[model samples]
Target: MEKLDVLVLLDVSGLEDKEKFEKHLKKEGFHTVPDEAFVYTAESSTTTFSTKAYILEVFKKGLQKNTFLDANLIFLLNETPYPAYYYDKNSNDFELSESKEAI
Candidate 1:
């Protein structure tokens, strides 16, 4: 299976049932890491190394640099030449967009 990314809206305080979350996602056959700043998937129709790298970069920034917390809502993309959609929920309404630059 190829690496994929899923952006999760995590609580600033922390996540509840984190282990369970990972377990549930894994059980459903989607690669998961609940404690990660962002959740990613490998269950996409196709996989690419670039996409994998993009996911890692975003997660690293979110976890290490706290970029994910910068906005109530932010959009992220799966690492790939053609990015996937990550909805940001900070605004009055959910926001959506794609990544154009390299991760």
Candidate 2:
């Protein structure tokens, strides 16, 4: 499987434990995008799942335990930008956003 390039936008503005969250992100193997706040990138190998499915799994897995947070996940499988996801406080999980620029 080809490596998928993923862009992650984590909104930790509401969280108090920013250091812990950053540590968690580092442990998850995500690299911070240079000169960008809360922006990250990761290369993923998706052999068994589609790009969307893979990103959803990643987004869910990256959530902070016992805290509701929001994130935007964008992945490119074949050039065009796929739908992004946002953390829905009501659902307490990631949900698809209509636009990649959605906030």
Task: Give the candidate number with the greatest lDDT.
Answer: 2
Which candidate has the highest TM-score of all?
2
- TM for every model, in the order presented, reads 0.32, 0.66
lDDT of 1 by residue, 1-103 (tens): 6434544332333433445544554554446455565344544434455544544344333433322332222223353233333324343222234544322
What is the C-alpha lDDT profile of model 2 across 16-92, one tens digit per residue? 55556656667766777889877767776765255456556555655645354445555544455666677777776
Error of 2 at 69 (Å): 6.5
C-alpha lDDT of residue 20 in model 1: 53
**Candidate 2 Cα RMSD after full superposition onto the native fold (Å):** 3.1
lDDT of 1 at 36: 64
